[model samples]
Target: MLRTTVARLTVRGLLGSRRGLLLLVVPGLLLLMSVIARGSSADKQQLTATILGQLGLGTLVPLLGVVVGTGVISTEIDDGSIVYLLAKPLPRWQIITTKLIVAVLTSWVVAAVPTLLAGLVLYGTKDALAVGYAVGVLVASTAYSSVFLLLGVVTRNAVVAGLAYALIWESVVGNFVEGARTLSVQQWGLAVARAVAPHGGISTNVGLGAAVPLLVLVTVGAGWLAAVRLAGLTLAAGD
Candidate 1:
């Protein structure tokens, strides 16, 4: 069935192709930043917090999620190859689910692991910061992957939209707009960090109670919508 095919394809594309190389770039950058941060005799706490919050959580995680998530479907759609599967008896939801799983896992490995390593390099188990950020990255990775994958399925402009959400909305506006902070994924991940971090080490614009529900809602709701949209997905002929 399409599900099996999708699973096979997802694994192969994620692990075997040149596309897998893209997943390495963010984590590699994280490592590089960690080294540079260590050399400055910076305030270890502030440096750790800045790297984890500003770069790791804010930039790298979302960028990896967008790349992996959209790569799962967008490449195929662009080449008109999705029709090979869509034209068959396979249900489109299967493809969406398999791709979602692959994208989420890829995002976690590339974004989350490097975050923990960077945390360790910067702070070394201090205040459980590494563990906290790792958890937040996983949480944010799931939601981001779902949203971007949906964008990939539905729009040729998926990367642009994903970048806008990650950079402009989450990074730029979330910093200034108090209400927007409540709705942002960065804030949601920070909420998870607030829960896991030692005492006051981590804080978030959105409270633990509100953030937990919003994270669940956004991640699950977006995933569900992605499956539904994939089922009804359409592909037009050559441009």
Candidate 2:
């Protein structure tokens, strides 16, 4: 269901624009902070857990998700360029999937790579902390792309809506509300990290059994929804 033509245009729009700078800057900040943290006198394992788990996974991953995820398609819709995709004799699912593929792969490089590098800088490879959090960030990146892409497809204020959901609901509410943690992408990622590095001191409210299924469900479900919604958007635009 991948289309190179659509994927090429999506990459140009997402990375060849000013927003591409953000994709670099955010990850740059994480690396810088990690270097600074490495020089500190704090416990190495604790620092790794806090920085990689909380800052990298909880913050940077999701923020990049919103940026890359929504950016893939929202700008085209806003500038009335999405008609090009609709004009093609292609299925809407292929269109959404192609854009989502770009978002996920871009996010892995921009966000997940930094997590791995930062994890190493902060705590080395002891207990596989770097690889573990990097894997978690990878998973969260995919799920976030699908979800925020759906928001981009169905809403006019995709950036604003995505930021609100990520900052307010995912970060804040998901932290304070007990029931919210179960559904948090951040928490689910933490679960994966725990599994990857069982001795790495990673901790989260979710267990791997539930988190695995939830992650799969959200990623696949949101992508499917975006495809369905995209058809409606094409119809609405036509009329």
Candidate 3:
């Protein structure tokens, strides 16, 4: 029941709307950059790392997650339409789970698939960089989608906040500050890559054991919090 409605809303928000175009744009840009870089005198190892670490996971994954995750509920909340659904006989957790599932799947497709292809184009299976980064993107996408989706439910400036977290915290601070790296999803995913990648190819500040726990905790915690938030969600009236 609630799951069905949330599923309908999630799919519609993903594929049956203008926002779908934005989803298309991110992956298209990744592939385009991969193609253009193929023309240059780029070192395949550096190129693959840059694209996967910086562009694919660092930029596109979070961006798409913010868009798709927030699109599932924030738009409805913004328009005061969620009330109709909330008024029904449905548990809030069901809605949250359904939307979260949609967000996770969408994020994987837009972020992870292109990462593999870009990795292939750049590295050509060298040192297993392609597969490693692909797996990293997949794992990171799940965690990111949950975090951003929770943000969507709890904040009006979800996109702004998500971007700040993705670009400023993860990209800027994670690189400059060693401590920040341990707390970053980018680093955690990189840890996963490090475990699977050929020796000395992929590396992260956080180890695989720590990263796996953090990923699961953040994802599940955010999702549970979102369910609680949704249960008591209130709409602001336009004055």
The candidate scoring highest on lDDT is: 2
Candidate 3: deviation at residue 80, Å? Answer: 1.3
TM-score of each: 0.91, 0.97, 0.93
Task: For candidate 2, write residues 1-42 as lDDT tens digits.
Answer: 338888988898888988899999999999999999899999
Model 1 lDDT, residue 180, Cα: 83
Model 1, poorest ten-residue lDDT window?
Answer: 230-239
| TM accuracy, model 3 | 0.93
All candidates in order of lDDT, best leading: 2, 3, 1
lDDT of each: 0.81, 0.90, 0.83
Residues 1-239 of candidate 1: C-alpha lDDT, one tens digit per residue: 65777878876766676667877766898899898888778778888888898778877788887888888888887787887767777656667777888888888888888888888888888788888999989998888888888888888999899888888887778766887888888888988987899553675678888888988898778778877776666434321
TM-score leader: 2
Kindly indicate the candidate among 2 and 3 with the higher lDDT.
2
Q: Any residue pairs clashing in model 2, and if so which?
A: none
Off by over 4 Å in 2: none
TM-score of predicted structure 2:
0.97
Ten-residue segment with the worst summed lDDT in candidate 2?
A: 169-178
